[model samples]
Target chain A: MFDLKPYLEVQRQRVDASLKSYLGPEDASNSRVTQAMAYSVMAGGKRLRPILCIAGAQAVGGDHEAVTALACALEMVHTYSLIHDDLPAMDDDEKRRGKFTCHVQFDEATAILAGDALLTLAFEILATTASQCQAAEHPKWLRAIGKIASAAGCNGMIEGQMRDIAFEGTVISIEQLEALHGLKTGKLIQASVVSGGMVAGASEIQLQALGAYAAHIGLAFQVADDILNVTGDPERLGKATGTDQARGKNTYPLLIGLASSQHLAGQLVDKALNALAAFDKKADPLRAIARYVVERNR
Target chain B: MFDLKPYLEVQRQRVDASLKSYLGPEDASNSRVTQAMAYSVMAGGKRLRPILCIAGAQAVGGDHEAVTALACALEMVHTYSLIHDDLPAMDDDEKRRGKFTCHVQFDEATAILAGDALLTLAFEILATTASQCQAAEHPKWLRAIGKIASAAGCNGMIEGQMRDIAFEGTVISIEQLEALHGLKTGKLIQASVVSGGMVAGASEIQLQALGAYAAHIGLAFQVADDILNVTGDPERLGKATGTDQARGKNTYPLLIGLASSQHLAGQLVDKALNALAAFDKKADPLRAIARYVVERNR
Candidate 1:
């Protein structure tokens, strides 16, 4: 068995350690915001994006340590997104990851600045990582950083967020919903895969294959999330069920029927697994993760 | 006479044109957020940061075109800062540059996304600029991007902003005021100067002098701003006066009194001019700009 849980547990600790070193828990001069940033990121969650980043590298026959910094950088960006998404003006989420949201725990302004700081910190980490790579790989690192920045920038995640807010209380088509999540979540997921391939110095063909795999799973992950939002147990899910319907979000289960939505997720997961047919046993983590994404209740 | 006004006007137009092409007035798919971003930036201000960037490059005899993208990138960053600073959770200002603040013009969500988008675009422009430079200058461009990101990132601008919000409604000393603005205002201003020098491939000695000139003028700029907030005419300033004191913000005038603050600004301009003495006539723009920063009504 691929045993993804053990792998995830080890990588989660590794990511947390690197993040602590990269952005320390405190600064004598600037403790409050620093503390807030470290607090929310350290509070805990599944290190899904970073794990995917590592898996992407391993699938391409690259060393996992080579991508540790990039993996942490991606997680930082994800954390920053959550902090901003929970703002009073945005989703107004009072809790996240089984704890009070950043804005709820700290004041709003601190939370805003913390999110901005974390986003900016992602670039800082990537730039520093670029400098640390071998001279031959420096250009690759730079390109990877740029690609990640583009995915999180206006053209990708931020664009998706704008659409999400604008579509509130308004009817949106299924195609529009696909475009929405594609930008918001899919782009970054794709970037994580592509960036890992770049670190491995993979060929353009290999990168495209990775991209295909990521695209399928990106959609599947969101589909599963929609189903969980409607059908999951609150105690296991760590949040209320039916939040998407309550918010009137255009979700897979909302537009498609619940049974069909589950069916769709399974199909997507199969597509995701098939994208890795070229790889050998080295890609087992990805193979296992694809199935886990569709089957996990939480 | 060092007539910097014509030079500034010409450069302002140049920067605006590049920004229009880089981020057009509208996007067919994402018009709303794009328009909000373009509106605040293209609405027109002095373009002080970008002009300073050009002057910094020119001081070291670098071609202006080499720094054009970097200059525009700085302006985008400056615009983004204003957008975020005026948010409902922050300064809560409803007006900027004699126009309704972004949050007031659009919704708070749009304003937040616009600010986020503009910030992300800054990195995009910088990365694109890196690709256009000479092969030998690639590393320099990458380093420049990192430096600019660091200056604008958590350890620099955002850190300063956090301290700003955290220190609200508290008594602060003059040293604390300088430290606050140093990160909030000084760091980015310093980045603009440093980035311009980096684009020109300035030597260590030349970069140091440029940095000294920037340091003096950066503080002088904020000192001027603090004074104007108390004494400026709202129509001329394009924003309300006395709002700083009303918010109980730590300002130069509040700590050192108005007359002393004005005196300090003049002293800083003198120091800035002295630093540029070693530079040739090409540096006249830097000298003139320093004085203009203090002397201008707006």
Candidate 2:
């Protein structure tokens, strides 16, 4: 009964507006590089990560605007990951979100710098937010920033990326696939939820529950993505469909058959919902998010 | 004479030991990436940034130990930059500091992951330090981390790098060179000094002076590097000599003649020393560093 469409549309608009403000005006003097950055960042996409961050904060009875900077930061990290993942040295995809990837649209070097700039910008936004917050609130904001930093940095997503690249062209065990997804995809999503919780001043128990909710949904989201890549319409997806199998990439669909992947995704959604059981009806958005993760077409 | 060699040696040992302890064990389980991180981090460099940090702290009569984590974080950022710079898509250098580059020794993907890991670890160390510090000290540490994150992030070093790459094989003004070096090299070094000052609880006046001091010396440091790249002994320098020229990269020596570049470096060193005039004898180490910046053969 929870219609997420309207909520998603509103959240998307909020995230997009905030991102525009966060990126600031492009330097006319350095238009070439700055424009390239804006082109990719401002390009339309789902804005799912930042929306999740806003929703997560709201789920914990916190003001969404309070975590706006953190939400923008989460999106920046997500965008940077996509930019790098699409590079020739990595996944080598030419399109992302139905447009030419940063590297393809720009030169490889420009794309690299743009991605680097975006990554650095994420931390800068977080730092600026910490500084602007009330003195009493600085530590918690710093902690949230730290969580995002760790999730995006080497010990987490980057390491997972390495495992992914190394395991390509080779059959990977499901356990390894899970670990890879946990680091590459799960950590950032978990950070998004945890950041919202921190900003909202959620209790330790609530934060832990939110983390579990995020992890379950994060995995479910990836599984769904894998399924879509295998079965979704290329035109609708805005990216190449079935490219995962074509590239011999390890994914949930490859590890488990399509039917099994869908089933696993359902179980993950259930688990994610279970993790939120301790929260009141206020957490309906997060519950809806879990279901949406498995049901989203793109 | 202050006997900087011994001081440098002692600081190097301390940093190395702390870095090892901080990185934890080198086992294959959770440590493959950790070990790769340590391998590049511990492989050793001049540790100039950390030394500068310590000198900045000392100039303000702050406890050097308090700033040690910040110092290490600075070095981590520097190392990560180097690892990424040596990637095939970038500088394509096979050797660094006289040894095989990370990508050459390990696979390119591992090297990329290692760099990513180092960057993340730096933030983790800063965040953990901020969390553990006294309540009043937490903001100071967060500010220090912020300074670092900004220096290393977009609108700073990465922007400089974009310009550097774009300007390659093209005519550039001396001002452009300065801007490029200021962002690419000076920002991190400046952060090192400023973060150190922050850790030492420096007054506003002292922090501003320290920043000025760092800016002067950082520019001088790069000019000195340009000089060395063209004139220094190849064996002592470890990396290839005249790489800038080979790559058609713009540098001080190329922009201005060698003699003018040397003169500019000396002037900047003097400016660096002049910035510390307000400090008492505690600033002597910093003054010594300014002279060392230009006088060193390697």
Candidate 3:
């Protein structure tokens, strides 16, 4: 065993610290929007996207410092999505990570502005980072930014969210459900991994391999999420169970049965691991992460 | 004297066509969110920001084609801000540009998503444009992106929106009102002009002049807006008049008398025109636009 537990703990702690530093300290002079942004982002999650970003960079022999800004940007985008998704107009979620959601803590208007601020800040960070780099490396950062934006933009996560909203309370085929999840969740995950590689100057072949690995793990991650929604402890999950079912939202388990969903997740994890066979121990975190994606309780 | 009417009309049409092209064609496969986005973006407006961007580039001897994507990106960002500002949780407005607001035409959730999609797309276009540019010009594009992002990010438009909402129904000082609008509206407008100059490789001195010019015009524009809110025709303005008074929102005319506010706007426009002293006929449009900002009925 590669001791994935300790590895995850260390990476999560590092990302958490970097995120706090990147967001900077909050004084009384800080606006309510900034406070809300800090509150939501610091409210704690698995930090999965940022951790994957770091791992992707590391797999190509890049250092943690090299991807710190990029990782923080990814986390900011993820946090913004959560804030907006939890709004009254969307999921109407009152709590997340066992804390009051942004809109619940602040007003709905503040929450919306906070989400907008975070999304804009993500690009600010990206553009600032690219500007700071040497001219030779500027293209890499720009390419990574493009990847992240596409993953978050109309044809990717946003479109997926639209479809998800439209499909609510209605049944769709398994393929459609998979495609939806692929857009909503899988694309960002794929971007996280591939962008890290891109910033690290990964070869085209390596980038393709990382993309393949991420695609598998991304779907597996969502499938595990569906399973957790039905079977996990609410306390551990920091949210109520069966939200998808209650909303009449489509899920892998809902369409394919729980057993098949679990099997499919396991198989995806295996495929993800296989996609990383060319890399040495440097890719251990990615490999361990794929396993953790399916096997973790929450 | 410069014939600003024909100039403005021609530039507006060019920007309108470019915006349509940038957004691309809508088809049956498009999601409802996309439809809502198109519906709101295609609604009638002055197209001021994009025009300023194009003018800024031209002032630096850059052709229209050179800054087309950037101009479209600025318009998209401006449109996204308008959409969000009209949301029920924010302005709660029912109409904008003589049409039903995004939240009114579509649902609140769809409107929110459309705004988000447009914001994300703006950055996508910026990053893609930077990526497509020659390596020699890449730094300038990245710099422009940094400037735009900072103008639109936490300490910029979003914070301004937060403060605006917080100040609703509460009287504030003149300085506070000016500061609020400076961030909320002035910053993006400044970025529009400066980013255009930047993409066209304006010298540092030229950029500073453009910045000064934009700052003066930006504040003048808002002062004029306050005057219009108090005095303009409801049908001409698209939305109702006296909305500032209805919301108890602070305005120039509220802080000072209407005649004094008008005087202040003319002074600011004069300052804006004086800021362009170094430029020749190429800067005529900017000078004319500054006058238009204060003189327009709408």
Candidate 4:
């Protein structure tokens, strides 16, 4: 009976509103760099990570406001990553989310500054938000921020990106593909769920369970993305389809075959659901997310 | 006659030693991304910012170890900035500290990841360090991290870089130059001093004084660089002479004559010294740093 459409919409709205406030106004005294930052952050997207963060926080009885700053912080990091990814030196995409990429919309210099600004802003938000929270909760907030930072940084997603670039035009083993996906995409998603649980004061057992759920879903999400890239509609995906194959980039389907990829994705979804078995009925939303991860077309 | 050479050597060694330990071991389990990060971070530099951080902490009766994490964090940020600044899209410098820059040494992709990793590691260090600190000090630590984050991010140094890029080859007013330098260089230096004071539980007045001292010295440091780029020995400077002019970038010597630039730098050093007058004799090192800023040939 659970409908992901409405749930996703509500969460997206909440995250979007918060992000709008988090970016604030463009001051006249502000330089073009600041303005570029605002434009890039305000550019519309699904707000999946921030919404996941809020949902994760709420799932554990945490207050929305307690994690609001972190939600914004996560989005900033995500946006910065996207900006850098789109640079002429990287993926060099001219468009994202149906709009011009940061570097393309503004200049390359502005894009770099905007991305750097957003990354720094994320940490600032985490630090300031930690101070505003209760003394007992400060450590938890700090840990959450640390996890997010690491996931976005070199040891995690960025490293994965390096591997992806290096492996371009070459066939990668399934294990290598999994490792790349885990670092590139899984860490941030894991951080999103774990951060929420930390803020809500979830027990250690519960935290571990949530991490399992996140890991499974994170993998499932990537598999689904790979599937969509191969089969999804261009209008719905908001990006060019078949580019992954055309670019000779390794993907789940490429390494394991489409049927095997789908089977693997299903197994991940099952694992995600099983991980949530310990949670009370309140975790139903999370279960729905796991299912949606593999089932969604885009 | 206090000589900073020995102290500088000692501090650089300490920072270098700590950096090696902080980077952790390189292994198969450790991704190539992290290896690249270790390469860039372990690459040699003077460790001036970290030394300044430790000095700032010591000025307020805090042990260097108490601020070591922050010191490492500052160096990570500084290193990341340099890596990005040397990208083909940016300053495009092939050399730094007399060696091939990160992008030139490694692939551009690896270099980018290395920078990302270093920046992320900085926050992780702060977060983990803060968690290990006394509970009562958590708020202070978080605040310090937040200040550093803000200074590094969009509203600060990155924005300054954007303005600097935009104003290249264009005549900039002195006030505009001050604003740019303040954000680009002054903010991080200010954060270093303020963070040290915060860790030491300095009074609000003391914190303000420290900030003033750092700001003056920061500007003075840039002015000295401008002067040196024009006047210093090429061998000692370790880079091309008059490159600023070659690139058509504005500088203190370019805007106000060399004599005026020297006089202005002297005035700023005096202002920096005056700001430290509120502190007792413990502030001698800081005063010495201000003098060194003006007097150093390299």
Candidate 5:
């Protein structure tokens, strides 16, 4: 079995160091907004999306250094979403990743601006970073950036939140629930994986396989999230566990029961791993990630 | 001496027709969020940024079709800013463009999501549209996108917004207020003009001239806005007069009296016109726009 922990940590440390440079200064002038942005990012999550981007690139024999920018961009998008999702207008949460949420720490308007800034910064990073690449790769940069945008845009994650809001407290079909999760959490995860592959200059066959792998793993990650929401330790999870059920949220566990949700996550992981069969040991991280998604304590 | 009304109208109609297509469908599943996004964009405004983009490209001899994507992208960013700025947590405005604000028409959460969606869609349009361009233009696309992102990101509009919020009900000097508006409103306006120029592969000299022109017009536009807030007819202005005073918001008229403010606006316009000395009638739109900015009723 591959020891994925150290690999994840190594990338985590690297991203953490560079993310600050990309963020520029929290100067005395714009300190409040910059502080909120840095606070939210540095509060810490698994950095899962970025690590996935790196692994995907590695699996395709691509340069990890070249893909670092894309990985950071993905993480920024995830960070922005979390900040917005925790706002008084959305989930109304006061804490995130073991710290006061952006709105709670800074004022609400500052939080909103911080989220806006972070989201805008993601594209800025992608565009500027791509400029450093050879002229031949410019089209790929545009395509990759577009994919990231769509995954996070109206028809993707935002729409999923809209549907969730519309469907809250109601029993939704497995398909409806699946589709909702697929958009909310799954799409970005898929984007994270596929973005890495694209940066690595993936061939059509490799891209397809990566897509399949991403699709399966994305759902598994969400399913596991739902399960953790119900049963995981709040301390480890860095959030209260029962809010989903309390809010009558539409989730895999809520729709099909916790046991079934767990089983579904397992099945999805199996599919995710199978999709990577064509790759040799080079894809060990991808395989390990799928398993870890269902097995993570947090 | 150019008649800008007809020229502005022609581009407005073209952009309005295509803007809807960029927003995608108000699908039944995500109708609430999609509706909010559509409603916000469709609500009438000058579409100044988009027109600036088109004018910038035209002045540099670029293809209109190629730059239309960027034109729409600028509009979307503008729309998103308006939506967020009106939220209860931000400007807390009840109305905009003589209509109920997005939060008023569609709850705070939906409004928030709509703003986020619009922002994301801008990048999506840039990426996807740039994909259709010739390979040689790919780097230009990245540069253009990066410029847009920087103009709108934390160091730009959002940071400016942060300052505006912090400075509300507090006094600020002319220089401070100028710097604030320069970032808040001016950067994106500058980006709008420059993005079109970049798409057309502007020579460095032409780009610098456009920059100087944009800088002047941007400040002149804001100065005119401050004058109008205190003096213009309420109906023509769309929003109420003296709200800036009511809110203690800083403005040129407040800082330096209406007469001086108007004088400053004219001077800026003259400077903007002077910046175009190197270009011929190809920049007629740019010249006309500077005049219109300080002269328009609203």
Candidate 6:
């Protein structure tokens, strides 16, 4: 009986604390860019990627301490993507995480610099983490960093984003939409889990299993998001539903029927659980998260 | 008796070839982001940063081949900075390296993603390089990656950029101007040399000397730019002169005097050369490069 609410709460708090320390105390000399970075990072979310990272480590019998910084780096990368995506030239979104977006809160130039800083800082943290580890552990950290970098880079997330922008206002196939989400949203999520396994010195086979688990849950997470946008109670979600339809954004339910999208999400959760069949009970947190990914109201 | 011109040409060609291969061939499936990245990266420039990296490695008795990927990573980081700085929300420049700026050549969203891809590609290159190294060499590559990341990140180059923007159209002091340039332009320059030395397994004292050499040259490079802006022939520079003053941008020439700025640049070059006193003839390329930093009209 792993009560996921408390488990998630504890993990979210830990991640938040690490993020605050990593960004450091804002001094008078610390530029507005740092302030802008902190503003968005602290705005708050579910800490889903970081939690997935920690769970991956635990499932492999690795100490959570080993990948705490890496987890924070993953969240930073996610936050930077959101900040950039919200820019006037991109999504032009004025709000995120229930707060005014970075561009809306600060000037556009400062927001851009802040996002750039966060992305650069993520790599800085990864390399710095590798430096502090024992010599024997260098390769593990390096491999993890390499995996995360590729997942977040041009051939991965950026390409997905470019595809998303290009396909906007045009009819895209269901396959195309899934492929776009796989690259844009799924790649980082998958990398987060796989990188945690890497940090724990998991075998190649174990890493592959983790990758499979992540891929299923990653898509499930997106499908759930699209469902919530269509069916969620606005009060529980803290926002209006059907905005995806209003913006004509591609979503699982929009491409497929709502019933099929829900069925697919449930099937994805089942597949995600099956991917962890070889692991012991230490994988319970991951199993719980998969269920919650589809069940969460918001 | 080193021929600086031929040597620089050889090095520039090598860096270009490596950059081309690193970005890979464009495919029809390749999104516009990759195309934009290749366009800006392949555009002609002095390739000064990569050359400095190679020179740093050579000064430490390390083969230039050892740092080729690292050198290319430095150039990519430099290119990303230029691309973002030219965006409409930033400098709004229409041209760079005698070609249309990234944002001008491509749409703003594509340009943003292109700059993002280049920046992310750089770290991917660094981690991939570390992963490919022998176990004993892993620490060296990791240390170099850490150093480069911090230099390119918020507390270093980004902060410098923030200050440069914050100080624009203001009457800034000479010390403030130097500090601003030191952060914006100097940190990456210094890191390029220092990280290359790290990659070559230079001794602490040797690394310190290289750092000192880089610091002087970095400032000299900027001072020369200020002097050029005041006095350069537009034909030679391929652009208009005095634009720094026309835009009320802070510069050594504006804060001090043209004669004083020129004298300062010369003094910086001498100091840079003196910093390499402990190095052998292998340091000659670095010496020539330092002299060229101040002497180049463009």
Candidate No. with top DockQ: 5
**TM-scores, one per candidate:** 0.96, 0.95, 0.98, 0.96, 0.98, 0.98
The whole-model C-alpha lDDT of candidate 1 against the native structure comes to 0.84
| Higher-scoring candidate on DockQ, 2 or 6 | 6
Runs in model 1 with CA error above 4 Å? A26-30, A64-66, B26-30, B64-66
The 10 consecutive residues of candidate 1 chain A with the worst lDDT sum are: A22-31
Which 10 consecutive positions of candidate 1 chain B have the poorest summed lDDT? B22-31
lDDT of 3 by residue, A217-252 (tens): 999999999999999899878889998888898998
Cα miss at A20, model 6 (Å)? 0.2
- Ranking of predictions according to DockQ: 5, 6, 3, 4, 1, 2
List candidate 6 stretches off by more than 4 Å.
Answer: A26-29, A238-240, B25-29
Q: Whole-model Cα lDDT per candidate?
A: 0.84, 0.83, 0.88, 0.83, 0.88, 0.89
Query: What is the DockQ for all candidates, taken in turn?
Result: 0.62, 0.61, 0.81, 0.80, 0.91, 0.87
Q: How do the residues B147-250 of candidate 1 rate in per-residue lDDT, one tens digit apiece?
A: 88888877788878877887888989999989988888898888898789888888888888888899899999999998888889988878888988888898
lDDT of 1 at B225: 92
Root-mean-square deviation of candidate 6 = 1.4
Interface Cα RMSD, each model:
1.5, 1.9, 0.8, 1.3, 0.7, 0.7
Candidate 3: share of reference interface contacts reproduced: 0.73
Between candidates 2 and 3, the TM-score winner:
3
Which portions of model 5 miss their true places by more than 4 Å?
A24-30, B24-30
Tens digit of per-residue lDDT, candidate 1, span A175-270: 998899999999999999889888987788888888999989999999999899988888876677888888988898888889998999999999
Task: Give the range of the ten consecutive residues with the poorest summed lDDT in model 5 chain A.
Answer: A21-30
Model 4 Cα displacement at B243 (Å)?
A: 0.8
lDDT of 5 by residue, B1-298 (tens): 7789999999898888889887655555446788889889998899999999999988887746868889999999999999999999889999998999999998999999999999999999999888998888888888999999999988899988988998999999999999999999999999999989999989989999999999999999999988989988889868899899998999998889988998999999999999989897889998999999988843
Chain B TM-score, structure 4? 0.95
Point out the higher-scoring one by lDDT: 1 or 4. Answer: 1
What is the iRMSD of the candidate numbered 6?
A: 0.7
Model 3 chain A: worst 10 consecutive residues (lDDT sum) = A22-31
